[model samples]
Target: MVNKSRMNRVAAAMAVAALVSVALPGASAQAAATTPRIDLRVLVVDDGGSSVEAITAELRDTGVPYTRVQLGGSGRPVIDAAFLSDVVDGRPRAKYQGVVLPNENPFGEGSAEMAALVAYEAAYGIRQVDAYTWAHPGVGLEYTDSGGYSGQLDGTQAAVTAAGKAGPFGYLGGQVAFEDNSALVPESYGFMGRPRAGYTSYVDAPVGSGRASLVGEYTHDGRSELVVTFGYNQYQQQFRLLARGIVDWLTQGVHLGQSRSWFAVHVDDVFAPDARWNKELDCTPGDYACAGGEGKESTIRMSAADAQYAAQWQQAKDFKLDMLFNGGAGEEWKAENGGTDALTAQLVADRAKYRWLNHTYTHPFLGCIQDTTTVPWTCVKDASGAVTWMSRAEISAQIRDNVNWATSKGISVDRTELVTGEHSGLKTLPQQGQDNPNLAGALADNGVRWVGSDNSREPAQRPVGAAQTVPRHPMNVYYNTGTNAEMADEYNWLYTSRAQGGSGICEDNPATSTCLPAPLDTDTGYLEHIVPAEARTALRHVLANDPRPHYVHQSNLAEDRTLYPVLDRVLDTYRTLYAPNTPIVNQSMKEIGTELGRRAAWDKALAAGRVTAYRIGTAVTVKAPSGVLAPITAPNGTKKQLLLGTADFGTAYAGNRSAWTGPEPLQSSVTLRLPG
Candidate 1:
């Protein structure tokens, strides 16, 4: 009983359904058929400018792999559609997730290369960063001449906007002050302009009577660009502060590298005394070069009151300091002072309050036997002309005895961690050109896995037997000084010219030193000038994602407690500039060493092209060498795939979650499900 009209309607409905499926596909089916594969790599087009170099440096330092195409350089890769993207296995594949250009238009306006870049960005939904550019309509901003301003940005205070706080720069608190290192030299320069339609400002500064954008996002033609109106080098404080946000925005919160601000302070000579700096002789009394100063030797050692104060300060700041201690030195001091050291007793009472690393039994020079007959001591050599190095037994005893002593006092310490006195047992530039022959053997004997080195001398981590060197930054608060006046006087002696009553060292080494305009007033200089300078330097390291611990001496914790002012300023400024989500990452010496080792391995894997990471839809796949961990940063809710179920991807940091991760059990690669 088929009705002809009904049969016709049913047939027509079927045909319409087929047509609709062909024209507008279902979400899952469409994604499966044509999902875009976006590579977790950045393409940097360099114009040989400081701004471009600055961003490039950030990418490199953060362990984010990138390809550089030098503009105006011979044999540079052409910016063509085929070069930017391709179809792989019937799906579109973008070679780079982000593109960093020297400016809004690096290949010139209306050029084929520029056109190709624009088309590629639009097609792949790739973000671009105008590393540095002048404000104009091209970047969706009014010209500086029109109700805007352009000039040096040094000493200017910029601020993150509401839009920024809600976007990639959510980690920052608000203010960003440009550094004015020298009044005679211009450090930063920029142009500020009013944002036009489709432009959202991230960071802005005062312009005329109102605010204008310094860094902002401009959306147009199915693509977006992060436009930066400022000029800066990689070392500039402003650049370091803003680099993480720039990279985050470029990658859209998903990348193959993770970054966190790390800060750790180590107080060396914890149980020993530091020699006093002689203002009259312009040298430390106990040092080799200070002649006729033996009888006048005075030492700066922490007292029981200072130890109590240190514990209180740590509780107040919620920070822990690493104690690089010498057990024999403390015992000797105790014997000299009626066999009762109040400082030692106080520190032992609060043993669990601070981290501890072995600084040897006695703070003896372990590199070589010194021939002290010469003014600048030389290494002693045997009859055969070979260097006379401290024996392995002696070195191992120094390391072993200290750990035993700490254990006896019920103080928890990692036996694998050691920081030799003066970073000895390693190479000393003018005297010992190489590590002591016995040093490696001694370190291996003691089961030392992490040994501290001087960052100023050996900045890079290297192996010594089974151990790796954990480079530490020497804070400007001198080991010899326990007072502010001594620090200032020494600073003036090193930085001022002979005409200004200094040693004239700054005049001789102009490349590495800056001569002060005038000698600092010993009474007021350390608080006014030195504290800010040292704090700024330390903050720069923290902002750079450097995990190296900064080392000051026990002397800094005694007497006037000179180190607290600088530390307070650094911590306060850091808190003011960053939100709680981006808390400073503090790690132990061994942890820092492990981190550096893992980073080195990861970097090696990336450089050898042994790692591949890409995102398809909300799924990220990262494949690396089996033993190597992959560094990943993604949205807060991202989850890592497991053999059976998913797990939280990484710990939260800088407004995202990140970790050095490896594949789950039975999995071939590390895979993550990104938040929608």
Candidate 2:
């Protein structure tokens, strides 16, 4: 049994160490590359429980390659005479650093398989990490005790062993939710089990000539083995953190780099109206039929909402905001009068704080063909299913005009980044999967390096035309939060038919303020519509380490009473749950674009499989494949030569490479010769 007092001291010390690393971002990746790493992969054994997929997902996400074996159900392990020989020379002959047993049954006495595993551990000094349920003599406990702890306990008590206390896996100190029916190990003491033995959350057990920290323990032939346990899969995020710590521990501190995720919000369709904003149910002149019955255009007045949004932004400094503008609106405002609107002025005044991108001059659907029969501009599709697109010159004009307008307004727009109004002219071209050369040429001429796509269509980045296309999840405020009628109308208008859905929230005529039959409950919308979307986005980003740049419209902020309150709730929840002190980097869309481009370049280079390094008496020579952007991690600043092989390939790095933010793919090979 473990000593409770010693375990408590150990946990406290370990927590401090872990926090120190978390507090200082990038500390885990700052160590010199000269440190020798243990060359072994993890062996995951599934005993038909909830942890197989969960464990595999974490391993895959973190880039920890693993071999899996189904040890449950019909394939259950049995003790036969040949089992010892099979275990001694199993199919998974790869050198395994450790094993993971999820909800496993105890390998009974005299069992050949169990004996073989014990013999292997005794010979190799490799231990096992168990999650939730496991019963083996090697685990140092039996499930013979009838009574077990249950109910909603917050976490394990602070009786962690001294070794555990001084290590990185002491995450029981972190905020975690414990569920009902969590099994208890009767043999262990302190936070893990009944208070009979010493407080033993973790124990450095003596195994043959080597030492192993037993989170749970057992013995055979006077030899002990270590087994670390996390409660269950319900506590996935917390469980993954502990799993990561265990990987680090078992591998002797060889870092399995996990990228810290980032997030941003891009507000689109921000532009000046062709005419002074009005409250009446209105439409573009000569297009009255388009507005539908009592439908209003530009109903969300930015003049009144910009200040509120600014205040909310001040409160949420860690949240990134991108203002995507339609240059035509600003031009129209300036051409109409002296351009003195409070909304535009406020945006200009706070210009330095937010990232700005181009939507277009007039915000036309660039992917759609122009309808000459319409007044200003309209899109049409022919019988052949091809949507008519604007000419290259016309597309180029939209890009250039926007850049000029934004520059004149002191809004520094990154010419390399553009979010086509409605994400038009993207990979989903009507006829050919190939992009319109005209639009591609226009973007290239305008120096646009990155274009935005939607997760609804494509969840990852792809090359389109001359620009690299990055994606975001569309967080439409109109969805879910709006009332039953409001939700129905919005969905219908977008996907099915505008005539069928009516105009929904935009139906209210400003003049009477009573055009629409039903209105939105903005108060409850955040919880109903926004919270679900936010939670999904946050959890996805956390688990996959993918960047989620959620996109909304300027009108989303103006819709209903005000969108700031809802925005506040959604962002706050994400901050608290996914990333609190160890916060995700709040980045601009352009920055995100740049990061994605670099990642692509690195991935491309890594895929070519030509990276190699060798050193003899400090004369180091490295050969990196063409187009690889990241530096190879090898023994440096010493006379020692680092071992090189395919095993080192595909190792993940946590941050961006130096100055690798450009959209252009690397085009050449790199070779380095170092002087001793």
Candidate 3:
């Protein structure tokens, strides 16, 4: 939960890779990398660039292991290929495979050495790093654009364009632009900030066969005119587009090395019972088709039986997808009389294609602000009138009951697998600790695995009754916040347009105005459109953050059980790996749910004195003094043999010293026959 902040959303496709052509000014819709191609020796040449610290910091944040070799010596011409090889050989030739030009003239102790290093990049595939340069030649870099513009490596360029006007110079603080259309980020430095000025320039992207993928234009300002774009992870389309473009132009895939991205997709409204409810259809009496209206309703609501399961084998292919997580969906509408049959067949047919997850017994918003069953729920609500959930028993019922039904439906539920009882709300009760456990704990106790209390779905926080609630961040469990609002707000035209108060608040600045920026994020759209697609995209960004990430979709399951062989393999690559791409060998959600139900029943019996427990080595004997007396008791000196894996009956001792042993499967009766 956020406090004192307006709002934000997740990241967008282009935001991930803002790869643009400096020469073309308005090309790439983004926003990457190498490792597996050729194992080339790497060298780190340093120049006195100010952002060196920032660049290093970003690399470390990734937590990916890499070797760094620093070039050090008194001023000398070390920029030649031989210089790089000599240093690499002295250390470990084969070990080195990449280069970091954190600053300019990486090959050198001097400018002459730098020229030699540039040539080496051609021979051995080395990704050179230049934080910023002028978009057009005659600006920050010496790379002459085909546009007939040539400039020095610094921003100070003479007036060769005849405009006699200086180039656009400002802080490249937000995200580097891909083309000239939009910003790489949604902070104040977004399109709302970079207006087209006389000096604003762009370059061509495919810098011919041998040159880099891009060229640039430089301005006269001390700052670099072009902000070179790079990708950390390619969750969205940006990186793939750029990589393909580069590969096509250079005719090389080997140039791209070990870098990779995790892919996944989820179905909520897209291929679930939820979509069936959107429009009324006409059918027979028992048939769901009756009302031929456009909107959904009780009598004529849509059902999951048809959308997710009603399809014939051929139609099922439409629902197939490429993904890292198979986000389980809520399709209760399919459980209806006729719908149930269809959905059951659907699950049986399609279970093989995906992993099954326990989304919820009945996908209810566990912490819904208001009950839609009573009145249409809305985000805005009166404080005192805030909605509460069904009773704990009710919540438990929904979860347990659903798991049983799913299992009965032939879905191989891994009960150890879990999804939030209700995803968007708080996972716990207002009170904390064991006795006052939250939804996650309840799910755990009940054998449901992978509980997410609250997610970054809403991505908000506020002062609630003088309390500040912060979200919990978990990798495979409770993924607190995914993306920020500022990043998400960029797609919406309203956020970019300037108003009377001004829509230009720098995210780097304090959030004093609604227009003020916050941080990198994707949007959640307006309050209206949170269809299942919303959930899928949200999960996509979350998986994108971690390279080769395994997102355990406790919420997903397949329609065909036979396809599980293949699904499991795919899941191994994407799910949590106790060992890489290996099976969990642990309990599934179905087993957990069943065991939990059994335990709950057992506990109830025990509370009624129908059962007990004991250590492995306790002995006792029961004796009756009178036939008509109550529960029998044994003398203090008596001992009883304790059996393992068996229920413990009460010890035959008198008074408070009387003890009990193991458990009761499910009985609420106890006979007491003691001597008075």
Question: What TM-score goes with each of the models?
Answer: 0.94, 0.63, 0.38
* Order of the predicted models by lDDT, top scorer first: 1, 2, 3
- Show model 1 residue runs off by greater than 4 Å: 1-33
> How well does candidate 2 score on lDDT at residue 187?
21
Q: Rank the candidates by TM-score, best first.
A: 1, 2, 3
Model 2 lDDT, residue 88, Cα: 17
Alpha carbon lDDT at 126, candidate 1: 86
Clashing residue pair totals per candidate (backbone < 3 A): 0, 19, 103
What is candidate 3's lDDT per residue for 1-676, written digit by digit as tens?
Answer: 3321112211221221121122112111110111112221223444444333333332332211233444564664434444543222223111223344543333323234443443343333334444333232222332233322322112111111111111111101111223221234332110101112323322222232422222222222212223332222233322221222221111111111111223232222222322111211311122233345334332222133433532342143322331111122334444445455443454456665554555555555554344333322333335795434444565555567666766665666656544443343353333211111234445544664334333333222222222222222222211111112221233232223344223344322445323323321334432222222233343343322222112322222222111222233333323321112211122232332333333334334433543221111122122212111112122223332333233323432111113322212242222222222
Better of 1 and 3 by lDDT: 1
> Which has the greatest lDDT?
1
For all candidates in order, the CA lDDT equals 0.90, 0.50, 0.30
lDDT at position 102, candidate 3? 48
**TM-score, prediction 1:** 0.94
Q: What is the lDDT of candidate 3?
A: 0.30
Q: After superposition, how far is residue 243 of candidate 2 from its true place, in Å?
A: 5.4
